[model samples]
Target: MAATGHHGAPLLVVMGVSGSGKSVVGAALAQRLRVAFVDADDLHPPANIAKMSAGEPLDDHDRRPWLETIGEWLAGHDASGGVVACSALKRTYRDQLRHHAPRVRFLHLDGTPEVIGRRQSSRPGHFMPASLLASQFATLERLAPDEAGEVVDVDQSVDAIVQEYVDLSAVG
Candidate 1:
């Protein structure tokens, strides 16, 4: 079933740098909200994946199409609502997403680089290498005051993070 809170079915983007637990938290949040979940990484074009796999940071040109694809997904799910895990690391990127999915809300999983880097190192088989984490951090723009979003500390347990969102959404 779709979320039936004051906001109705909510379009949520779980966003952060690599290893900030976007995927884990997004999945759990979607389950709790009874909404569908998707990992934005899966929507990337093969070239983007290959560039990241080779330890190269993707430039805006490479990410534009990918971001548009994600936006399209959000548009398609606007009525039903859904959760997507994505590294929406720049204000412009988030703006682009909002252009396509105006009602979308973001959950930024924030933490120190030391904490996140360690987590990135531990993950194997992921296309994004730890070497490029610095680039991601450099690109990240925290949600502005006017943005429809919340920042959650990634240091907390997954359940705790998910619960916090659940509580916040309940009040809205």
Candidate 2:
């Protein structure tokens, strides 16, 4: 995989609700783009982890600082961008990530609840247990046309998703 148009561009946020293949597709896109990849989940504070680990959902208050952290990190990747897998379910979250890297674009991994739930149930050893998936869906804010994001349905293979993303993003 080769990165095509990203010689000088802002970072990309491969985002969606939980279990939407953000990590998988983001990794492939990063490889194709020859850029670094970061799992935004790792940026969450212990409190956020603890909350989720305990089968609890985080309120917007809990998400703000974490979003800001991501925004701050984007400063470094403004040029020679990278890809980050993030469950940025809300427009505000995406906005925050873009603040530091205005060229930041989002790739939303859209999927049905049945599809995503099955995918989540198959994975293990993650803080985001399947029990909390309902909360994730409840919190998800669909991408509107006015939103600065590209929606990619997750029914196809990861390669296809990456290819679609690459095609949609001129910077990819």
Candidate 3:
């Protein structure tokens, strides 16, 4: 089945703290939706990647450009849609995407540190280190349900998670 968003060109921000299964879910959602997937990690500049690889967490200043770039991509996505996995840990960052593309929606992946840590440790070569997981939680700004996006628990299967997102976003 062809996938569609709540509005024209579903621009999804698959968000979460580190290790909340953003990449996996975003990839799957993209495939299911038949839209291009953009892992916000991939949009990170080399320096940012290096910083996280060295076990340092990124600050707002460091993340702004990357978020803006992702927002830019959302702004340019086709009429069908797109999805991005990003650790948009702050309200401002999520807002930046909304500001860039008014139609943009966020799918925040939430899970406990233990759950995410185990997931991160199992994953193959990635720039983000498990050591920084706490920092992500520390910086996370929990969004209210009525706010700019939807929060999803990541403890469920990926298909279930994506279906929830797809269903919620399908509501006009």
What C-alpha lDDT do the candidate models reach, one value each?
0.90, 0.82, 0.81
Once fitted onto the true fold, the runs of candidate 2 whose alpha carbons sit more than 4 angstroms away are 1-7, 170-172
Worst 10 residues of 2 by lDDT: 1-10
The residue-by-residue lDDT of candidate 1 on 29-132, one tens digit each, is 88888788999999999999999999999999999999999999999999888999999999999999999999999999999999999889889999999989
In model 2, what are the clashing residue pairs, if there are any?
Answer: 3-33
- Model 3, 88-118: lDDT tens per residue? 7888888888887777777889888888888
Q: How far out, in Å, is residue 136 in model 2?
A: 1.5
For candidate 3, give the lDDT: 0.81
Clash tally, candidates in order: 0, 1, 0
- Cα distance off (Å), candidate 2, residue 149: 2.6
Q: How far is candidate 3 from the true structure (C-alpha RMSD, Å)?
A: 2.0
How high is each candidate's TM-score? Answer: 0.95, 0.90, 0.90
Q: Model 3 shows how many backbone clashes?
A: 0
Highest lDDT against the true fold, candidate: 1
